[model samples]
Target: MSDAQFVQIVGAVYEHSPWVAERVVSQRPFASAEALRSAMRRAVQQAGEAQQIKLVRAHPELAGTAAARGEMTAASTSEQGGAGLNQLTPEELARLQSLNARYSEKFGFPFVMAVRGHDRQAIFAAMTQRLNNDRDTELRNSLEQIDRVVSFRLNDLISG
Candidate 1:
């Protein structure tokens, strides 16, 4: 992508999302991917609780079949669709579905993780373990995990 396109993604992220925009817009003219991610983490730390909630809401849930948020492009959608939960083997898929049902029933939202490189078993393990976290604790933990995803994606957006 052209530098203009790269910057546009940043702008797009900022336009619809205020927390990121507030942290990044002033730091514009980023020199490198590292610089952008550094700025992102700092911004997340500086973000208030409400802003953190907004950021958390921007992430896609871990459901294999659901569309990821912030992935507006057809390519992103196609990629995630192919990686849907049903892609797992029958046993693993069933386990994930059960775990997901239990998790959502507890939290009132879908269980979420950045499943970029992880497989079904790993996801199941994470879900099962994280299920033990209390409501407030898990909410914060999940949000931190999402910040990692946002940081990675922001890095790719700026540098690729």
Candidate 2:
């Protein structure tokens, strides 16, 4: 596939960063979808700290202002909705807001996770557990989470 079409398919895998897919497209005809995913993850990982931080920060908060305004990208809207984040009651929304605010303040970005298989309670528990981590640890964990999210997205787009 051409770079443009390739980016369209994989761009949302990294939140709003199509450039991640754009960079990987040159290494086309991946032996397997997994190989393509690894290259995408590595591109972000090998980036300077500033770039990595920006990539992480590009993600919207769960039920955040973007969600409130219905401004999330299609991929994010689906992911958040599938996690039942879009179904929270007022009290739960408040709880998430509090946790999100604190997490972003402490870590300099939204809490990152592959929430596809998790419920609200589980996500909350993770947020609480991860809040105590040092900055370096949290940043690394965020990248890992990004990798998992991308993997899920790739599976949808590629059979292998």
Candidate 2 lowest-lDDT run of ten: 151-160
User: How would you encode candidate 2's per-residue C-alpha lDDT over 1-160 as one tens digit per residue?
Assistant: 6789889877867888888988788888899988988898889988888999999999889889999999987778888899999999999999999999999999999998988989899999999999999999999999999898889888976664
Ten-residue stretch with the least lDDT total in model 1: 67-76
Q: Provide the overall lDDT of each model, using Cα atoms, as 2-decimal numbers.
A: 0.61, 0.89
Model 1, span 33-137: residue lDDT tens: 667767866787688776765665554455434442344433234334445653556776667768878877787655657666666567778899999988777
RMSD of each: 4.4, 1.4
Which residue pairs does candidate 1 place in steric collision? 64-85
Residue 112's C-alpha lDDT in candidate 2? 89
| Model 2: colliding residue pairs | none
TM-score of candidate 1 to 2 decimals? 0.69
Give per-model TM-scores: 0.69, 0.95
